[model samples]
Target: MEEAAAWLAALDAGSATREEFEAWRAVDSRRAVAFAQVADAFEQIERLRTVHDPLPEPRRLGPVRLNRRNLLRGGVVAGGIAIAGGFAMQAAAREHAETGVGERRTVVLEDGTRVSLNTDTRISWRIKGETRSLWLDQGEIALNVRALAGPPLRLSANGMRFDLEPGAFNARREPETVALLVLKGTASAENRAVRVGALAQAIGRDISVHPAEAVAIDRARSWQNGQLVFEGESLDFVVAEFNRYLDDKLVVADPRLSRIRLGGRFTNTDPTELLKALDASFGIRAKRGESGAIMLSAS
Candidate 1:
């Protein structure tokens, strides 16, 4: 590990040639993992530092000057075997993705309608002249769909389909349910599509979803631009979303607190503030672990 970190510092120092680095990689698979691990380690170090800084806005932190001595020491301190490889890189390419902790992007449809990608969201759309299809693999998104001039517009997730006429609002998919929350437009499950909300599984033989004013499957929305919008959601559900944007995830010390109700518009950058806000609103307590990671427990 010490040797690998020294090699990384040499790479960063611009002293090693690409051919040299490639030659080192050719030596063995473990060497490649060790090399990549240095970058991951640096990222993790930076990410963990934010927990202590607790600043709301971004600032300039000077570059790291890793030397042989510090490289050996830090490598020993931050020891981890990197599992990410060529296959992991290829697996990521299977899906179209964009990520932000609490940010959203408006995706315009063919007929000039817009869809918003929720915080930490990823969406894939396949455009076809005859029929348009979109899919949400994970996270939540809002589809302000426009009327299709020629063919019907279709949205699918986990083998479920939704047909939209004109106006629509939020659409989401989870492991269990698919929801279409039409704020302004009309939406219905396609014929032969037996899809509904998560809890409707037992009664889903007909594939019918009852008309709802607004619906959600996994996570909630935010009132502010990048805030989280949770509605009577469990603590664990909210924490999962918060962790989605974080390199360092929140650990619950007690399982009982995870089921507590959590609702708010939380800033994605401010996990500490989010936790404090939740603690103030609900009967929750928090503690910092020895490593400075935040842990929450129900009081």
Candidate 2:
């Protein structure tokens, strides 16, 4: 097991060659099994770290003595293969759903849970007997969870887990944080409860919850209606939000234009109307850049 851990660490660090790994694993059949177990344990530890601790102190592993009894005990030869195969089956059972840029889609899970995906979003879910898990890889989604017997819906995003009651919620994943807005019912993460009109923003293990403002809640609802409702938001903020749904992104070329406040409802798909409004109201020019980005600058 110690050797397996050392090999795994070396592989992870990109210091181990493929030829060297194959030669080492060929020495003993049990060595391969031990290495698989060590790799699995490492993966499980990483997942736990993401959920419980963002930055944990490193700890060195002590010496581990291996024996024939230890190798054979748990039917390691047969059980190791079974465990590896089981993981493959579990992955296959998950149904993946995604949306491209400027696209929106709604999906109904096997358990009747409705999920409305925003642009450029990726998610996978498995709804089977005694298993209800959804993984949000990126982007945003609004979920209307169905009431089902047994355990509540388990949502995993950015390695954080939230057990949600039958309710409506909007979740968005950014580069550094995951934001959850509870529209109805409740959700619990790390033993903290989040009720309706509450917003929970998680940065690793640190999660903070507060009441969502009326505009924020309304914005969440408007996305499903193919619109973006901005109420006196900064030009920079509105541009960033609009870029999410656009392949040809909006860029603020002038720093002076970023702080300008604007408010209105606009279609999520096209930025033409918003650009015209900016030009008409604030003398902001929208020019098509070489890279096809819409550059916003003062006229």
Local distance difference test scores for all models:
0.56, 0.79
* Weakest 10 consecutive residues of candidate 1 by summed lDDT: 196-205
Per-residue accuracy of model 2 over 34-106 as CA lDDT, tens digit each:
8877556444433322333222223212224444455345444555445434444444556776677778888
Clashing pairs in 2: none
Tell me the spans in candidate 1 whose CA falls farther than 4 Å from its real position.
1-97, 100-103, 192-208, 211-224, 230-233, 278-284, 290-293
What lDDT tens digits, residue by residue, belong to model 1 across residues 39-144?
Answer: 5554344333333333232322233443445434334343432322322232232224344554556656555756677656556554646556666766677766
TM-score of 2: 0.73
Q: Which ten residues in a row have the lowest lDDT in candidate 2?
A: 53-62
RMSD of each: 14.1, 13.7
Which is the leading candidate under TM-score? 2
| Model 1: pairs clashing at backbone N, Cα or C within 3 Å | 167-185, 194-207, 221-229
Off by over 4 Å in 2: 1-86
- lDDT at residue 22 of model 1 (Cα atoms): 72
TM-score of 1: 0.54
Given candidate 1, what's the lDDT at residue 244? 63
Assess every candidate by TM-score. Answer: 0.54, 0.73
